[model samples]
Target: MSLQGEPAHVLIVCTGNVCRSPFIERVLAALLPTDAGVVVSSAGTGALVGRPMEPLAAAQTERYAGSPAGFAARQLVPGIVDSADLVLTATRRHRGEVASLHPRALSYAFTLGDFADLVSGVTPEDVAAFGESGAEGARPRIRALVRAVAARRGLNPPLEASQVDIVDPFRGDETRFEAMAQQVMGVLPTVARALVP
Candidate 1:
């Protein structure tokens, strides 16, 4: 899909737009080619608009890659949902919240992990081909293998289901924030490839 006149827009969602989502947005922007013609932004389904990222998250993010200078948090609104070509949320609950607010987004909305799956075209048959016994057992095996490869290459593994949710790390310590950030960052390049390629 050529992001020509229409820039591919991605909106990352979380609880307060102060932690996971913002970190994902910055990492995506940095990982993607500057001329890739994709516009990346983030919001919180229930955010404290005009606020900065949580102090701990900000500190951790900065420690790894310098401060997210001038970054300001924003609340998720219908307009943001409507404008996004892709909507990635932190969890299944967050996906539901966004969908309830913008039912029109149901098709485009997915957990970041799930979107990764869509891009890779990993179907049930593919899972079965692994011959890992039952479907349930096979799916995780496939996902883990893919995730391992992605991690090695700094890419996002394809998601197995849109329902596969990322755990939120709100009100947690810097360690938690770092863990969440690492997960989000891992998947961002995959998202970027999907949007730009």
Candidate 2:
């Protein structure tokens, strides 16, 4: 159920689609402004394909997702990435997979952690220019912010693995999943504000 005639689509990708990607998806869905007309979803490079998120991950999503009914795992494909306005991949390698599917996606796709790091410095002034038209104005503003981040992609030296990625915690115990969710959530607050600010 899309709101806008042409909504901004955010596609998050990971390996198993059970933990990180689904968690991020629900967070974004809950965090983004309702009027902003942004649609967030997740898929996996090697997804479970029609499965639910991990129990621990699903438990965490309730704190942010408003309900437990929204998370579902699916396989990733070029067509899904192709339709996205922004593609936030779980790993650099996943980003590579997205790029391999669509060369132009490079401009729109980013590793989630790297994307968070790249845009961490954005201020209220950066978002203020979008004005107050609600959803009508949020789309261009989001695109502007994305471009602002994309422009800085190569300026920084390459990120070591830790800074650029969140470790996969698919089959791990509750402790590992908690740590991964914390990292993902840490990046969420600032970036989520930028998306709907």
Candidate 3:
């Protein structure tokens, strides 16, 4: 069900941008094929602007087959949210921040783990059907998928905060960074598959 034109931009957000979001961004980049028409990027709600990814987080990125090369932290802005077709934030709090910046984004923005859970039950056929019903091109298909996920909200049990929020590992130890990687990677592969499979 992968579409090939009109790339869909996916923005990942977190507090510092040097840890969770960047790592998730790189790992997702690695998981998705280059021509999948899905572009993954990251930003921070309160960024350490222009800083490279935290050393430990970069290590985790490499461990997961994702390169940490040349990543620069950037602050989240209204324009960034407005440009994105999908937004996956590190926490529910980050999701709230995105909605504040672009009220319309509430339709497509989601916590990374929460999005993983919601999209898990959506099959490739479902995505194809969604794509068929939307306007032409990959971006429309992505928008269709987002609409489908949003429609399913509240049909399932609520996810606890701990289940969806990836903890910040900017100043934490190796173990903390490892936990962040574990939390993100656990759900992200499912998300990638849903986006491109």
TM-scores of the candidates in the order shown? 0.72, 0.86, 0.94
**In candidate 3, which residue ranges exceed 4 Å CA deviation?**
1-3, 132-134
Off by over 4 Å in 1: 1-3, 60-67, 122-163
Best by TM-score: 3
Writing each residue's lDDT as its tens digit, candidate 2 over 21-110 gives 998888878887777778888899899988888888888778666344856788988899888878898899999988987888999899
Clash count list over all predictions: 4, 0, 0
Alpha-carbon shift of residue 134 in model 2 (angstroms): 15
* Tens-digit lDDT string for candidate 3 (1-197): 55656888999999989999999999999999877888999999999999999999999999999999999999999999999999999999999999999999999999998889999877666666666554666688788888788877897787999999998888999999999999898899899987874
Best by lDDT: 3
CA lDDT, every prediction? 0.68, 0.79, 0.90
Clashing pairs in 2: none
Task: Give a tens-digit lDDT track for model 1, residues 1-197.
Answer: 22344355778898889888887777677766666666678999888889887787777666556357678889898999998767888887888999999998776677787666555554334434533344232223433333332333224544444336655678877678777777766665676664443
Query: Residue 54 deviation, candidate 2, in Å?
Result: 1.2
